[model samples]
Target: MMPDLPEQKGFLEQEANQFFEESFSGFLIADEKNRIIRSNKRVSAWLGISPEEIKSKKISDILSIGSKIYFETHLSPLLKMQGYFEEILVELNGAAGKRLKILINAKESASKEDGLKLIYYTLVEASDRVQFEQNLQHGKSRAEKELEAERENVILREQLIAVLGHDLRNPLGAISMTVGLLERSIKDERQKKLLQILKRSSYRMNELIGNVMDFARTRLGEGIVISPREIDLKPVLEHVVEELKFLFPDRKITVDIALPEPIHCDADRIAQLASNLLANALTHGNPQSPVSFTASNETNKLELSVANDGEPIPESLQAILFTPFKREGNRPSKNGLGLGLYIADQIAKAHGANLSFTSNEEETRFIFAMEC
Candidate 1:
């Protein structure tokens, strides 16, 4: 055997080979004149060339258009002037028209025995990352446009409600005043009959005006005040039931007060809530069946359910039942504007209460509950 080499020399060779073979980064070694001397498999694969083909090729010939200019103008000059250079990014074309991003570095070898100065390079693919960034920017732009459009729509709706409410109130006030004066002045039987017709027309107009005002207030975020107090709800439920009984004498309404004691709530709002629920039940419940109103305290909440045996609300319509001005199938002319349930829902929420519903062939219930 030949004389054993020094341990340090053997170790260095092993380290150099390990660095080239195990690295995920593409590496290449070139001579002082920029002629390729050796390259790792990664580098050969990146250029679509075999190790044999890469051995004697010039560095400028192996590089893509962008990388060539950068290496000659910046990397080569720096290595020659400073003896070593660190991480310089460059692009190169790969096999099958692919492009790659690479970091280039160069340094003078520690041993001068071989007349070889090594220029090292590491490559990484950046096309996917670049495309991801571009897509993110595009998505942000689209979301901003949608937000601007939604804001414009809200502003337009508020403006329209304001104009409509103002115009409607003026004519409605005049007609109401005229009807009141005619009721007092008309004395003859025929004139009284005509005055009755005028009064009825004025009443319908007033109802429409009230609906318009309520809708405007809802849109403008007005008319919701919740001041909770300890009050007896039994009297309130009974009063609402009595009022409904008088209003709809043809239909039967029953009030079942399970909680005889007091409960905590905003009394005025709860009264309005009860009235709205009872009215809804009366309007939609079958004439042959009686509308039921039930209230009780359960767990930490005071629960109230107004159920009616009527035509089952379809599954699709249930989602939008609480929406403003949304009505079910056509009914008689006596049905008023669909503001009652929407207002009741708003009032319930303001009091930290939840309003929900369940409907089936046998019964339809609107349930409202508030924590005690």
Candidate 2:
């Protein structure tokens, strides 16, 4: 802390007056009746008047009409009781009819025995300060408008994505049905094989559309929807496995399910989450190893896990494993909109459950646990 000042002799009236005349502020002294008793050269120059002329005029003569009224109604009563006021905004009616903004700090300097009182005032130019604040407020308003516009554009883009994803569904369904019918009637083995390829490609496209729709729904603040009921999880798991097994006949998917009791959850949504996890395993797991699914119900919860032997995921990737559209750029061969895990996680959350994972050199596994 800085040391306090030492006591010293005060300047005499002549020295004080001379210092006041040379000060930067517009300095003035006025009596209790508001007549100008004295003013410094700074104030005299500001008013475009001589010092003698300023002394001859009332202080109100230099004030704008509004400030003169404010001074009488507010500042005078406040100073009378409190003996001082600081940084009060007032305007002066300039000699050329231009109004100049001023910041005033005033104090009661003397209260004589004869009931005469004197006040000291320092006036500062406030036009630049007020203009700067206005400019700052305008800039803030412009920034807010730009932000709002950007938000609206994002909403429009999400709406377009949702519409496109929805419209593609009917055509995709027709294509799948047409291909299935052709596969059943085809006599040539080679034509049958080509039909299978078409069928698989169409299914992949359909899955991509579904993921995009789910992602758009989430962005629009509509989370996954589920209808709860007591249902066996075994059938849901089997259905997903059987379909995936049909698509990838060369790969093996084995299921081992033993439920302690019926689960209270959304059966279709459970199937979807399981399907997504299986797809991830099939796409990323080593082709030589089979993907394994095991599900069981404990006394307090129903648990399902999918495991595959593959190169372990990097530790950095685990942090964003369930985030939407967070795919590794290096894996260009992978086909997805990167929404499967995110949608599965949302589904699990909607059912008041959690999706978690573990990975090492041996295998990567995803677990879904739902409390009863």
Candidate 3:
């Protein structure tokens, strides 16, 4: 049940009086005729008058002429109609006729039995109010500029993607097609070899473009987007091995995959990741010793690894191996931008997996593992 309103009013009034007495801001109680009946110590200090001497002073006597006119003309009528007026900017006549800018809040209250009215006033320095408003405006402006810049950045990235996907790829596609047509007509062995070189260069160029697009999307755009579904992962692995074997004909790549059931994954992305890892192994591994490709899907887990016999990756480089455009400084094969491993790692991450590696004097192995 609600407490009696008269009792609540009495309790609230006592609390309000305590609050006004301890407040840093000036407080005053005035009669209906605007004669000050009581003033807090803060008001006495600002006015350079004793509390007892401040009593019986008219509110207009302490206000600047302009503020006195404003109080009588606007604020007084507003308070009478609404019973309160808050945050009205005004000026007070301080000691020695100095002007003090302030904000005042005044409320009119009446005694329940006698109907005698009293006005309570709260005074605060306007300097703090002005500073707070300035800070708020500055923050709002900064946020708006940042939001606009982000929108512009998004537009630029989309344009980059369109150019990479359509404009650049279309020309590269034409070159590949023309190379295929010329190979059939060429008869001289030297000419044929040159054409073959051109073909391989085009293929490499296309691969580099694909890597760049994937990097931009995963790092700059949203992230590696995947269409995950149940897929026969064994065939996907086998295809990647076959493709890499064709590209690096002399380098042997041994595979051991045992996925007895369909695995849930983004098959094409997984294939791309496998191809990247395997290609990196072929490029750096000891030619005489075969690169090892292994995978297994068992008991709600999927794991794949590519191992190559090589000198150990440097400890410093290992820490930043998955970082884009970073590579082993000591390594010799510097064919393309160092994005292959970075893209591979991104693909692994897209599938809720992590790509990790360990290196020793004997071999370097990269592994991708996740819950299926």
Candidate ranking (TM-score, best to worst): 2, 3, 1
Tell me how far the alpha carbon of residue 24 in candidate 1 is from the true structure, in angstroms, after superposition.
Answer: 14
> Could you list the CA RMSD of all candidates, in the order they appear?
8.7, 3.7, 8.3
lDDT, model 1, position 272:
80
Better of 1 and 2 by TM-score: 2
TM-scores, all candidates, are 0.54, 0.87, 0.66
Stretches > 4 Å off in candidate 2 = 1-19, 56-59, 69-85, 94-98
Q: Candidate 2's error at 287, in angstroms?
A: 1.9
State the lDDT of candidate 1 residue by residue for 1-372, as single tens digits.
676679978998999899787677777777778788887888778788788888988777777897898788987898789788776666666777776766666776654666545665455555666677789999999999999999889867876866786788788788768867877887899987776667656654654555456566767677566688889888888887886785576888777787766788888778888888887888788889999889888676788899999788877768888888778865442376777788788888888889999999899999998888
What alpha-carbon RMSD in Å does predicted model 3 have with respect to the real structure? 8.3
Q: Local distance difference test, per candidate? A: 0.77, 0.86, 0.86
- The Cα error of candidate 1 at residue 66, in Å, is 13
Alpha-carbon shift of residue 126 in model 2 (angstroms): 2.4
- Once superposed on the true structure, which residue ranges of model 3 sit more than 4 Å away at CA? 1-29, 32-34, 37-122, 185-187, 219-222, 228-232, 259-264, 283-289, 298-300, 311-320, 325-337, 370-372
lDDT pick, better of 1 and 3: 3
